[model samples]
Every structure is written in C-alpha cells, then in structure tokens.
Target: MSNESVRVVLVNTTHPGNIGAVARAMKNMGQSELVLVAPRSFPDEQAVWRSVGAADILENATVVETLAEAVADCHFIVGTSARGRRIPWPTLDPRACARQVLERRNSGQQVALVFGREDRGLTNEELQICNLHLHIPSHEDYTSLNLAMAVQVVCYELRMLALEGSLSSDAQSEWDAPFATAENVERYLEHLEQTLIEIGFLDPVAPRQLMTRLRRLYGRMNLDEMELNILRGILTETQKSLHKSSTAK
Candidate 1:
C-alpha cells in the first residue's frame, strides 16, 4: 500500500483545536492528506496555532462541502463511531480495520478514513456510507474518546501496519488476485437487497433498518469480489426458484 493514498477526513468539526490536533496526529504517522467537511471555523488563527509544527498539513488541507465529495474516489471508506447506533454496520477494532484498509490499498485502491463531529460523533446516516465502522476499545466506564485522540489511535495503527508488514499470508495471496473488485461487491449487494425485497424478506416501505443490519453483517465479513459474486448468484437462483413456484401454484 502506498503511504500517500490514505486520506483522513474530519466531518463537521466544531472545534478548531481538535482539527489542529488531528493534523498533528496525521503528521506524526506520516500521513499528509487532511480533509475537512463543512467545518465550523477553518482558517481560524487558533487552528494554525494549535497545529504547532504540523502547519504544513493544515496549510495543505482540503475543505469540502460534503463527506460524499471528500470520499467519492476512495475505494474503501471506514467511519469512526464510538457509540453503537441503530445502524447495522459491523464495528471493527482500529487494528483490524487498518489491516482491511491496507489490504485494499495493496491492490492500488485509494482509501479514506472518516471521523465525525467531536461532540456527538457520526450520524447513523453518515455511518451508513462507510463500508465499515471502527471503534477504539477503551475502559468501559469511560469510553468516550476525544475526537483527536481517536484520530491518533487510528492513525497509529495504520502507521504501525504500514511499517511492520503484518499482513497475513492469505491476504498477501489475495493481493495478487484481480477477480473481485469493490465495485462488484457493491453491485452484488444492490441485487441481493432487491431480491430480498421481491421475496418479501424486506419491506420496501421501511427498508433502511434491515438493510443497514445486513450491510453491517456483510461488511464485517469483508467479502472479496469472487465471494460476493457467488452470493449474488445464489440470490438470483433463489429469485428464479420463487418465481417458478408462484407460477406453478
């Protein structure tokens, strides 16, 4: 994985200091790209002041209107969320998530790690866009992590993974396989959901909850393209079988 391809994004940050601290964290881990989506007070003197020696990151930071714009081209998107919400996305520890990101990265895919607002963290809707949710394990009594600290933890893991080459042998083997792509997985997911809806397994009127759960379940497994295609084929056959049964009846 190229060190230059991972992007760290802060969404709707209300604190300039946190933004500065995030820049510092990214720099500490050799990460350069820092993107801010709709931050409250950018270009504030305080942000630069807090950046300290990492001013280059702050200076080169990209400010955008939406998170979608920030991560549109990224092949992998991971969202940091501390609190478990109603959404069904599978949560991963920072180390594990970093491994998954690095694997996709080794295939020459651009990856983005997204952090949300400092106070409330990411919204359920925002979390939905991410392929996975990353949570930092902390003392159960006091699990709320400062936004900058969370960024630091995630960046630290990524830096360590990149430097140490901890990838499993299986993962290394898949690195050479060109059969499955992220786009294929996404299309297969869409087809599976449609099949579920058609088979009365999903209610079209209130689909978000179930789909979110299913998304989380599948995201946790991190299915490669070939696996995703196999799943899609199963769904297609099931759909055909159901159709035949209804016609015969």
Candidate 2:
C-alpha cells in the first residue's frame, strides 16, 4: 500500500499557522492527506504564508466538523497525547507508533495519525475514539511543545520508517489481506453493542467499560475486513434469532 493511505489529522486546531506547518511536515515525510477538524481559523493568509512550498498539501486539505468525520474511513488511528488521562489507554512512543501505522498501511489499511488542539491537546472523548495513543518522549523539565513542532517530530519518525523499508522483499512474499479500516471496526462495535442490548446481554444504561475493554481487544487484534464482517454477521443472526423466539412466545 502507498503511504498516501496514511492521513495526518488535526483536531480543533487553534492556530492557522500551525496548520500550515503541519502540512509542510506531512509533505516532507511523504504523507499527503491532511484533515482539519474544526480549526479556529483556516483558509487564512497566515496558513498560506507558512505552508511555503507545501501549498499543495494545504490546498488539498479536507476540513471537517468533527474528529469522527475526519477519521470515519481510517482502519487504524494513532492519536498523539501530551499527557496521560484518568482512563488509561494503550500507549506507544513515536517510533513504535510509526511502526504499527506502517505495518497496517503495508497491509492496505487506511490509517490516521491524529494531533489535537495546540492549547489542550486531545480531550478524553477524542482519545477514546482512537485505536492507540502515541506520546513523544520529551524532557520532564520542559515538555511544552508547539503544535507544528510535535507534528514535525511524528512525521519525521514516519519518514525514517519509510526510508528503512521496514517491509522488505521477504515480507512481501506473504499474502496480506486488505484489512478493515478503523471506521469499519467502529461500526461493527456499535452494531455489536446494539445487538447485545436488544437481547438483554448488555445493560442499556451505565454500560461501564465493557465496550471500551472490547475495543482495546479488537484494536490489538488488527482485524481484517473479513474477520470484522463475520463477527458483525454473527451479531445480526443472533439478533434475528432473538426476534424469532419472542414472536413464537
């Protein structure tokens, strides 16, 4: 799969100039897809000025209303977090995150590396939506980093992974199926939860962390399209069975 399948998504970005720099960083690293989610300001002169030679990335960027819309089609999503949240998440450093992303991309999966707003980073809700978390190891004394700089660091790691040719000729000999996108997995999860609720397998209100835990499990599995669809079909059939039993009763 081409690196073009990897998208760089910015969520709730506040600075127009930062968006430009992010585009530049992505372009330099051979990633071209740019998705902007609710930027405070865009299509502004400063963004164009800062994009410099990466005007194409800026020009072709897709602006969306929410993070969900931005990554709806992605198979894997790596969200960047500057700090830990109350709800723990599976975390990886920049290099490791890049490896996982490239691995998915090599198998023909659409992936997204998401960056949050400059001031607050990603909210808990936003982080929960991602498959995995990536944190840049910075000095404890001073961890504050500009949004663009963080984008550059992550992009640089991806660039290095591309240069190293991590998926060598030997790896290419194996059949790599087209995997399900993150969106597909997410949709299946929703379908599953709904089916369970319909059958009284899951409580409707205050579901606790059951779905969250299940998401973590599936994310680690890196499920392909066939696997995901099979699971969803099982849920559908189970729901149909429940309907038939109720009608007979």
Candidate 3:
C-alpha cells in the first residue's frame, strides 16, 4: 500500500504542539498526507518546534474549516473515539483498524483516519459521518491518552502491518465497481432526506434519529458508486411520482 493514499485528519485540535508531534509520528510510519480541520492554531512556532526534522510534513499539511471539506474526496473514513455514545457505532480496535486501512489502501482507495480534540473525542455527529469507528483498548484505571500518543498508537499499527506484508496485494481485485466517495454519499443522503420530507414520511419538525439511523445503515453498507447511483435514481423517481400525484389531485 502506498503511504500517500492514507490521510491523517485532526479535527478541532487545540494544541499546536500536538499537531507537530502527530506529524513526527506520521513521518516515522511513512505517512505523508496530513489534514487539519478547524484547528485552533496552525503554522505556529510551537508546532514547528515539535515537528523538528519533519517540518516538511507541517509545511505540506492541508488546513480546512470543516471536516466535511477535509475528507470529501476520501472513499473510506475511520473516526477515532474513546467514549461511548447514545447510539453505538461499529467499533474496531487499533490493529483491526490498521488492517482495514491497509487493505483498502491496497485496493487503491483513498482513506482518512480522523482524530478529534485533546479535551474530548469526536462529537456524536462527527463520528456518525465516518464509515467506521476506531477505539484503542486502554486500561480502565487510566483511559485518557495524550492526543499525540493516540495518533502515534494508530500510526504505529499501520506501519507494522505494512512492514509485515500480511495482506493481499490487491484486496478488492474481484470487486468491479469503485466505492462511492464521501461527497457523493453526503449528496445521496441529502436527496434521501428531502424525498422523505416531501412524501410526509419524515416530519422535519421532530425528525428524531431517523436520519442518524439511516446514516449508520449506509455507512455499514459501504455502497459502491453503482449502488449509490441506483439509490439516488430511486429517490429521483419517488420525487417525480410525488409531484405527479399532487398535480393530479
């Protein structure tokens, strides 16, 4: 797997030093792409100081205002979380997470590993957008980990798996269609929501967890490009029928 295919994403990072240290960790593991989402401060002295010899990583990092902008092109997204949520997402340990990332990378998929702030992990809404959740199994007595350390743990796992060469050369060789990108998935979801509202199936006033559950369902499916287009076409046909019915009435 080419290391450049995988991106390390930090969301709302508060400390520049942590960003620098994460750069160092990524450099050690042969990963070069870094994405910062709404970081408090970037290109600061503290970040440069911590990055040390890996200044190139800091220089080349992409800074964006939102996570959606950061990973819109990525086909697979892995979110890091430490705490439980009201609605549990599909969770994978570090090794398993690394394995999956490597496997996808082998298939020429662009992947992003998303990390949250130091104070608290990813928000429920942010985590929902991810295709899979990654949780590091730490001791119960002291579960808290430094932001840089958490990133290092996951990066190390990826490096180890790559060096071992345990995975197949082409993980998705048999699969004919490419997986849909994050942007396309988001569009499909928006269309689905609008169609549901138009049909009076989902009351936008209350809404509840219908959309969240649907996001979870689709995230698990990892729908390919063809699959996503098929779903979108269905939504379009449904909307047209609704329009026809209203006109007839």
lDDT (CA) per prediction: 0.85, 0.86, 0.90
Among these predictions, the greatest lDDT belongs to 3
The TM-score of predicted model 3 comes to: 0.65
Instruction: Give per-residue CA lDDT, model 1, range 155-211, as digits (tens).
Output: 898887886755554644655345556677678779988999888988888776888
Where does the lowest 10-residue lDDT sum fall in candidate 2? Answer: 167-176
Q: How many angstroms is residue 24 displaced in model 3 relative to the true structure, after the best TM-score fit?
A: 0.6
User: Candidate 1: lDDT over CA atoms?
Assistant: 0.85
Q: What is the TM-score (0 to 1) of candidate 1?
A: 0.64
lDDT of 1 at 47: 84
TM-score of each: 0.64, 0.65, 0.65
Q: Model 3: per-residue lDDT, tens digit, 110-131?
A: 9999999898888888998899
lDDT tens readout by residue for model 2, 17-54: 98988888777877788999999898878898888899
Whichever of 1 and 3 has more lDDT, that candidate is: 3
Position 81, candidate 1: lDDT: 85
Identify the runs in model 1 with alpha carbons over 4 angstroms from their true place.
166-249
In model 1, how many backbone clashes occur? 0
